[model samples]
Target: MREFLIIGSKAKTDKFSLNDLPGAGRIDILCRCVSSAFFLSHDIRRDVNVYLLLLGPPDPPKVIKIVGREVKYMPPDERGIAGLIRKALEVKADESWKKSSPGIYVAKKGLEELLDETASDVYYLREDGEDVRDFETKDGLFVLGDHKGVPRELEEIILSKAKKIIGIPTKSLMAEHCITILHYELDRKQLNS
Candidate 1:
């Protein structure tokens, strides 16, 4: 299975106004990334996993996990998506990785902890990194940062843990677009393999 780790530098870890998915001026981007990761040609693909690291108010950091086939309450728009994530965060704060609902898990863990737990080959997506097409592709986790980009400290952690840094050929693309392109490339590789 393929996995994605999206770092929401300002995404809230508490309940948010559904009407304003941009609860912290960046939650909307997280929603879009989730949508792209879960969507397939006709349905949600089962082989993908998305992890969102929220670092906003109420709670500084929280990890939200979405497993495609297991997610029972997917939202069609950014608002609903944000709501689902907020709901996940509503769970009691004592647990580190508690399942708030089907296919969704909330934890106090941050990006570094999640990456260590995943134990998958990690790839950091960067604009100046090696071209994805030329690099060896495998089933693993892809790490990306939101609009403002990953914080310097976090970027350092990612660089230390990542097996490689991947780059798309074009200018920097949106986080969601990068996922879609990576999926297509990986899919093509699987077909030919």
Candidate 2:
């Protein structure tokens, strides 16, 4: 596995609206509010590299989503949401950067802090348009993304890892969430790896 990207978030407003968008194969997961069955759902795209942006304050120790009958948890705090989203956007703005860096990316910085030490290594990218910080953690490496969703660059690695979790052939996409990988070489490599 390239790495494990566990995104713990409370507000997934953007992810919920993805079905309304013109696309396919998003994360194929859902982020839900605590104590609620409501969730943000998107299918893993076969073409574009996409992320679900949460539109709300960051909070943790809460239920974020129910992906495939599994419960995904959040940090219980969202104070860092603004900063995380910005960095996520920066990653999305440039997929060319992925060939160089690879790791997990998420939408909230607070979530990074909440990840149990079990997380061996993580790549945390946080941006605010005012600043873009990319971090690599060889041991317990974690990053906090605020506004923008997981960048395409980092998504490359997450997509690779996702296959290990779900064991299904995944589709690839561009930074804009458009189906870009017709022959999905990246997905192929991820599956093979």
Q: Report the number of the highest-lDDT candidate.
A: 1
Query: For each candidate, what is the lDDT?
Result: 0.85, 0.27
The residue pairs that clash in candidate 1, if any, are: none
Report how far off residue 172 is in candidate 1 (Å): 1.5
Q: Write the per-residue lDDT of candidate 1 for residues 59-143, one digit (tens) a residue.
A: 8788899987788868657887887887887897643778877899888887777888985799999998899898777688999
Model 2 misplaced regions, further than 4 Å: 1-65, 69-109, 117-120, 125-186, 191-193
lDDT at 86, model 1: 78
Worst 10 residues of 1 by lDDT: 16-25
Query: Relative to the unseen true structure, what is the C-alpha lDDT of residue 49 in candidate 2, on a scale of 0 to 100?
Result: 22
Full-model lDDT, candidate 2: 0.27
